[model samples]
Target: MVAAADAQNYAQKLGIIHGLVVQELGWDEDTNDDLRAEIEETIGSELLDEDSDEVMDVVLLWWRDGDGDLVDALMEVTGQLSDEGFVWVLTPKTGNSGHVDPSEIAESAPPAGFTQTSAISLGEWAGSRLVQPKAPSKQR
Candidate 1:
């Protein structure tokens, strides 16, 4: 189990802040409850589900090797995201059950209109941050 301080830091590192609406998808028996708790604590509210109609500041996607098509899932989440929001694609870390290769995420992102921003280890999960690329600025 992760210490409270560490869990707090993890949530903050993911850009979660007070009052932010965060939607969570793909929760299952294997999902990390402690991490979810920390996120809820940071946001000062419960995580919303995929069915939520509100636009979300962040989307937490718990994915696995066999969880259908990654591209499709990514695309679906975008409709609920605020323009500046990002998605955290969390999968089991290497050698763990249901671990997904980093290469697979990299390959799937673009077709879904996202760019891989960063990745980090969150206990038993590897979290990959994905964002829609901002349009290039025009200069006179």
Candidate 2:
């Protein structure tokens, strides 16, 4: 979990992005509560929990190394994203107990129909934005 100012900074980051925010905030209770309260107050956007009819503009996913079965998780989330929507995969930073290697994200995201658009450091978390892969254009 991040400290108060770190939480504030994280909240500020999420605030800049516009749209419905779907969160699969899979952190343990401690950080989860902090982040939830922070983002909710700062972002002030509608959030969805499980899958339903609606698609969201942004998805915030909290991931950890060895949490279990990433392929399955990716498959599940891919359908939740709108055509232009993006997913931010937040993982613990290196040296943290549950940190996930960036190389693994680079390798796995594409196989699940996503492309890693950018990487960001979100206070205590390492964030990567994954988006729908661009289709190859037809030959003229």
Quantify all predictions' global Cα lDDT against the true fold.
0.92, 0.70
For candidate 2, the 10 contiguous residues with the lowest summed lDDT are 11-20
lDDT of 2 by residue, 1-140 (tens): 44576344555565434335656546564244555666665557545566455666667778888777665677687776777777778888888778999988888787788888888877677888888876787998
* Per-prediction backbone clash count: 0, 0
Give the backbone clash total of model 2.
Answer: 0
lDDT of 1 at 47: 97
Task: Please identify model 1 stretches exceeding 4 Å from their true place.
Answer: 1-8, 137-140
TM-scores of the models, in the order given: 0.90, 0.75
Name the regions of candidate 2 deviating beyond 4 angstroms: 1-19, 30-35, 51-53, 136-140
lDDT of 1 by residue, 79-99 (tens): 888989999999999999999
C-alpha-based local distance difference test score of model 2: 0.70
Top TM-score prediction, candidate number: 1
